[model samples]
Target: ILIGEKRFRQQSEDPRTSPSHQPEAGITPSPSPRPRSPDDLEEGEVEEVCEICTPPSDVLVVEGQVVEPFSTDHAQRLIGQIMVLNAQIDRMQEQIDSMRYRLDSMQQEMKNMIDVLGRI
Candidate 1:
């Protein structure tokens, strides 16, 4: 997920603009350091200019296949599908509860019959 934009500020090697590198009047100037590549940038040099944008959702599936670059429409579709699945789960739970109730009733009846037979 891409949460924010990252901006990098590279340090300028120009000695004239930098006060710390200004040479003393009588001293010979020291040799300049070797140029650094983008990969060599220190941690502090990379600045994060955070513009908060909506993060992309986890991997989405379309028609039983995985899709890329999840959008708002895809999130909406996933939400709808989740709602449908929740409804189905509720119905199935109700059915299971009904079956369990029936089974318990049947078991009590069997126990009662066994007691009556034992009395005889």
Candidate 2:
């Protein structure tokens, strides 16, 4: 089955409304499940396609290696990695905001010092 279809089936089978699906301490769950795109398919999960369906030009090559179709498990792993990267990006943005605030404060102090020196 397609990854999206599989995910739909799983979601239908296991509703998130159940207490068992609740987020645990220090763990934030995804706000909502997203449908998997064709790009999300991994190497092992690809089924054989007819010549007309997948032409030579449609093949995927990476690092001099041809990438085959992958399974749902690989797709899940990719999603997990994406989530981690997103979390890291959020943390970095927060740090950048904090640094900008401090820099602004320092600039204001320097302006005050220059004004005092001018008056002296």
Q: What are the RMSDs of all candidates, in order?
A: 18.5, 22.9
In the range 57-90, model 2's lDDT, one tens digit per residue, is 2234667667778989899999999999999999
Backbone clashes under 3 angstroms, per model: 0, 10
Q: How does residue 45 of candidate 2 score in lDDT?
A: 66
TM-score: model 1 vs. ground truth? 0.44
Candidate 1 per-residue lDDT over residues 3-109, each given as its tens digit: 33433221233433355434343343233344455566675575333433221221133676565888999999999999999999999999999999999999999
Worst 10 residues of 1 by lDDT: 51-60
TM-score of each: 0.44, 0.44
Task: For model 1, state the Cα shift of residue 46 in Å.
Answer: 62
**Top candidate (lDDT):** 2
Error of 1 at 38 (Å): 65
